[model samples]
Target: MTQTAQLYRMVMEDHVCPYGLKSKDLLERQGFAVDDNHLSSREETDAFKKEHGVDTTPQTFIDGQRIGGHDALKKHFGQDVREEGETTYRPIIAIFSVAALMALALAVGSLGTVLHIRVLEWFIAISMCFLAVQKLQDVESFSTMFLNYDLLARKWVPYGKIYPFGEALAGILMVGGILPFLSVPVALFIGTIGAISVFKAVYIDKRELKCACVGGESNVPLGFVSLTENLMMIVMGLWMGTKAFLL
Candidate 1:
């Protein structure tokens, strides 16, 4: 009988060897025999090294062959490892710069204030449409990560499902401004969601975590301005929600 043996040496410390847990689960699920030796003390690690000629925690031995650390495990699991880039504020700064330019356009336009507001509204609607379309086009990726599909299925669904409808509704509302009664409510709802999403994006960036936002290429830190923007959106959403409910 040919016996396949898998051994794992791991330290029982918090947040260390995160991949070890994953590997253990995967190996068990795949019907591989696994032997786990937990080293809770330095003495244990030393004794393990004397026995196996390896002194590293989170090390794996397959058929008495050392497979190194986390990187090797990831490679064995068929994961594509890539070099992460140095995080910078370039992308976020660019986005804010564009927003500032739009604001400036609104400020400097020779047109009347009402016309400027209309232009701003249209611009916001178009921008939302663009983001919604991008998200929808890459629904699988975004949905799997940022959005909670199970919760959405049960209740509190994300706006992505009905993004096009919302965009169309916003466009129609901006067109005639006839339903001034409904405007605030719609805006408030969308604004609230947008704020939350932006906040989450900021949180991810601050923690140096990867996100699907910005196409996973850039890690943009969340700034105070982004928080303020979200708060403003929340206020707008509340105003709109109230109007929609009342009138």
Candidate 2:
């Protein structure tokens, strides 16, 4: 038998509460019969809020007991409740996941026998370019955030502004397997500086902050993600230098 639920939500002339709609959908999806009690007027909505001691609408009740709002309903159903200002690995995971697929596709399309090292190089380069593009989208915002913990950005203001472009240039050059002299140094120099800065901010100083690795508009925390990016650059840069020297 389907469980029954009552949802009290605001539905006014000007607007209908989206949360209310979502709640109704979620309950029904979970095999619940939802009684959607729409508060058609502001007065009704306000009165309902006052009666239940709730400041918001989209309230849910299950089995004659108040289950609060959408978030509460999710909790009751054993779902991960993600609130605002929460740290998540979604962004970095998405970026790298796509980058890996792209590298694999490129490797498969290659005519000659594709070296494993070359495939790895391509993956790192592509990932760098993708991340750099995100930062370049809002350089001013990225630079401001970068200044909070990046040692080079703090000392040389211009470095922050130039960072995205430099990263992109290095990645692009590396992808084309050209200008190793220029790209290798840029990768090494910036990667080293970034690694040191992240270590100081996160480990040494033990300060919590946002990472500008993706850009200023991102919510990625200043820690593992940032460290991994810098480390990848350092490894790739060193590899490029050694390969060039050996050739």
Candidate 3:
């Protein structure tokens, strides 16, 4: 017996409901014949919503039973669904993963070796820049989240705004192997403060909070991962500073 599903989605001259399309695709993939119903205009969409007593388009029905929206449809099929504000390390993982690959590529291109110390340096520097970029996207939001746990941000306020730019500058300088004098101090100062703040917040204070390491909008928790970021900056600063003194 062939299973049948009905999908009501918005399809206008200037717009198409994305979730509606997703629902249709999912139904077909799951071996169901979808009766695709399109609400072609605002009037029709409103009418459909009123008739169904639903507030949104892209409603699904299986066996003549309402299955809700795309997310709801996924739930019906027992798929993992991510709710808003859920804690996830995806952003940090992606940033570091890409940074590692980039570092390897740079190392191979310049030194013809992937297992060199420079690769690690490049990885850390690239990751720093990427993290800074995330924070810089919305400094106000980042600062707000940062102040929740950062000691310096709580006291100075402006430090939260300045932190991303400082990290970026240090990262750029380190990557270019230029101005060690400036980069070393900036990295060390911010890294030290960050390390101390994260330590106090997560370990000593024992207050669970979202990390501003990725950005204000991130759901990344304040814990080992956040501490690692600060520690990496500190180590990079010290390593480069030592090299500068030696050379």
Candidate 4:
């Protein structure tokens, strides 16, 4: 028998509730026949909320029992429920994943090589660019979060604001293997400081906090991922520097 679910979600002229779509998708994925109920207007949404005595939309009902919103529906299926402000690796994973794919695509298209040292270099460089873009999107927020752990950023507050730009410059140069003189030093300096700061904050001091690596709005926890980012930069800097000197 096909299980049935009713999902009440907001669908307005100017806006549509993303969670409502997520709920519907989830229901269908889980083999449920969903009766998607759209609240078309503010008045209708408000009246529905008032009648149901709920605070939010995208509410689900299974067997006539309330199942809350998207998160709640996930919980109903015994899936991981990430609450607001909870640490998540989704953003970092996504950025790196796309970067890797891009690197592979570029390597195959340009160099006709699938697995090579240059591919790895491109991956790291592209990842850095992507991460830098995230930070640059909201420098103020990123800097604020960066100040919580970065030693240089704390001592020299302006460093927090400049960090993303530096990373971006280095990444771009590294991607093209150009101006190694400028990019190499910048990458080494920032990478070293970031590694040391993260080490001190998470390992030596044991302070658990969000990583500003993806920016201020991220929920990525300060730990291995943060360390890996700094370490990659350091390695890339050294590799590029050595290659440049050898050339």
Q: Residues 64-167, candidate 3, lDDT per residue (tens digit)? A: 89999999999999998999989899999999999999999999999999979999999999999999999999999999999999898889999999999999
For all the candidates, what are their Cα RMSDs to the real structure?
16.1, 3.1, 1.2, 2.2
Across residues 120-190, which tens digit of lDDT does each residue of candidate 4 receive? 99999999999999999999999999999999988999999999999999999999999999999999999
TM-score of 2: 0.81
Model 2 clash tally, residue pairs: 0
Ranking by TM-score: 3, 4, 2, 1
TM-score to native of every candidate shown: 0.39, 0.81, 0.96, 0.89
The whole-model lDDT of each prediction reads 0.52, 0.91, 0.94, 0.94
Candidate 3: misplaced stretches above 4 Å?
none
- Tens digit of per-residue lDDT, candidate 2, span 1-247: 8788999998888999998998999999999998889999999999999999998889999888999888998999999998787877788898899988888778878835455667888889999999999999999999999999999989999999999998999899998889999999999999999999999999999999999999887788999999999999999999998898786
Any runs in candidate 2 off by more than 4 Å, and if so which? 10-18, 37-51, 111-115, 217-219, 242-246
Q: For model 1, how does the per-residue alpha-carbon lDDT over 164-246 read when each residue is reduced to its tens digit?
A: 34544553564344464565555566556655665555555343344433332335333444355435444544544454467
For candidate 1, the per-residue lDDT at 45 reads 67
Q: What local lDDT score does residue 173 receive in model 4, on the 0 to 100 scale? A: 99
Best by TM-score: 3
Q: Answer with 2 or 3, whichever has the higher lDDT.
A: 3
Worst 10 residues of 1 by lDDT: 145-154
